[model samples]
Target: MHATPLTFIGASVSWGKLRSAVTTWQPLGVVSTISVRAPFLNTIRLSSSIHHTEETDVAAIDLDEANLILDILHRFQEELGAISDAGDRLKQSRSPEVDEYRRRLVNVKGELKNAAKSGTLDGVKRPQTELERCFYGPAVQHAAAHFRLRTDAPPSMWLSGLYDPAGDVSYYTHGLRKLVDEGQII
Candidate 1:
């Protein structure tokens, strides 16, 4: 059995994607074909048959898209802060912030949906998943805490549920802030 070692040239490959591709390897034929792209190196696709190559659309987030996502995250912080303003109010109507929170949620969902529908998601790639989880994890915790507070549950019930979403917002924004601070994003 002869193995055709693949060589990547003119571009770099993401290790995570490379690892996943190699793990699912199958010997389709004696001669294996590999596709490599330049610039925004995404992944490597291994196949036994010849494959067509296409120009890769750059996976980048525009300033407007980045700001919209950041705005939603910032609103999450405001909602958490006002949870106590109407201590007696139900979670559904506790504060106007909740309504605004829901609105922002819908707004983001819409933006993503529209982007996908237009085949433009490649152009608006959101931040990396790890960074996204930073915001999402805390948001979930804060929501749980808010629910517990509304239900009059004992503090111990959600002792570990108090997470500040702004931590992630600031963490992510810090990088962007630096870029702008240095006149990089003007």
Candidate 2:
């Protein structure tokens, strides 16, 4: 008798929801509450009927919102840099922050570097595992949200819509991809 391999499924569903939220949500517009009805196996069902609303078109987001998102991304990048620099300093000597976050950053960086060197960063060759997919889902969504709110275009548009906003998202995504490619959380 041959036994079948049972695959874990919940992570994919969660990832899908997160991905949808990222791709569809607008920065300034409020996202309608999604209600799931009926128990469908391996399917995401929203209770609210999906209908075409007039707000689907991507417009120029306000300057204030764009500036706010840009500020947040810049801050996040600075935090990552501080942590990384502190870790480097610890390796050479020692520091107070090393005891808490710096050391952790060093360890994570090493692990991610190794993972990348081992060719695990190639998305086509080896897809991100369920855990990774779940972890990245939120980061991507948050970045996208920042882009959407900060950008003056529809959510359906890619990062190339607005010049300054697009540049911000590009920088943010570049940093984010570095951490992800290294297999570390941002």
Best model number under lDDT: 1
Query: lDDT scores for all predictions?
Result: 0.33, 0.31
Per-prediction TM-score, please?
0.31, 0.29
Candidate 2 has which clashing residue pairs, if any?
35-47, 58-154, 60-152, 61-152, 112-182
Off by over 4 Å in 1: 1-58, 84-161, 180-186
| Tens digit per residue, CA lDDT, model 1, 1-186 | 432332212222222231212222233333443331111223333233221223332222233333333444455444433433322243445456555544443433332233233221122233322223333333333343333222233223222322333343345455555554565431
lDDT of 2 by residue, 27-113 (tens): 223343321111111113221212323443322222222222233334434444454454444554444544565344333333223
lDDT of 2 at 75: 40
